[model samples]
Target: MRVVVQRSKKASVTVDGEITGQINSGLVILVGVTHDDKEADAAYLSDKIANLRIFEDAAGKMNLSLLDVGGQILSVSQFTLYGDCRNGRRPSFIDAARPEQAIELYETFNRFLREKGIQVETGRFGAMMDVALTNDGPVTLIIDSKDKKA
Candidate 1:
């Protein structure tokens, strides 16, 4: 499992011209699952994202966690994050999880975030989504569960 998180003023996901999920003053999480990913990956990433202290504090420092700010999460499953482009112009999704596996872990990740008391909105699993956001400070980071396993 891997995730790209961006602090956002507002964000939303649309599918087939219909808005499926939206959030304000929160984070937009683009999630990907590989074949090696498991339930524990979901738990680990969710916990990290919830506690990540990237938001500004009272001193205007980046010291507030998502929980501290009572922010929401717009979670979108994006297997394309695993697209590998080493050899050809066209990207390869060989590292991406099968749809069934990806969807399972994707939803599980959101469920874990919700369990942590943060509101979570999610786009339809396996759908082509249109995600838009006003990135705050463009605060973005990537986490890979495989590295944590070491």
Candidate 2:
């Protein structure tokens, strides 16, 4: 499992000209899954992201977690995170998990976030989506469960 977490002032996802998910003053999470990912990876990321202290506190220090700021989450499925371009100009998605497995883990990840008492919105899995966001601090981080294990 991999996730690109971005702090955003606002964000939304549109599918076929219809807005699917939106959030104000929160994090926009681009989630990706690989063939080797398991439920444990999803669990780990959910907990880490919820508790990550990236939000600014009163002292202008990045000491506030999403929970501390009562922020929402806009989770979008993005298999492209696994795209490999080492070989050629066209990226290969061979590392990405199959749609069925990806969707299952993706839903599980959202459920884990919801269980953490966070307001979580999501984009339609496997759909063509257009995501828009106003980056708060332009603070972005990429996390991979494989890296954690190593």
RMSD of 1: 1.0
Roughly what TM-score does model 1 have, to 2 decimal places?
0.97
Candidate 2 Cα misplacement greater than 4 A, ranges: none
Local distance difference test scores for all models? 0.94, 0.97
The weakest ten consecutive residues by lDDT in model 1 span 141-150
Off by over 4 Å in 1: none
- Per-residue lDDT of 1-150 in model 2, one digit per residue for the tens? 999999999999999999999999999999999999999999999999999999998999999999999999999999999999999799999999999999999999999999999999989999999999999888999999888854
TM-score of each candidate? 0.97, 0.98
For model 2, the run of ten residues with the poorest summed lDDT: 141-150
Our tally of clashes for model 1 stands at 0
Report the error of model 2 at residue 42, Å.
0.4
Q: RMSD for each model, in Å, please?
A: 1.0, 0.9
Per residue, candidate 1 scores C-alpha lDDT tens digits across 69-136 of 99999999989999999987999999999998899899899999999999999899888889999999
Candidate 1 — what's its lDDT? 0.94
CA displacement after TM-score superposition, residue 10 of candidate 1 (Å): 0.3
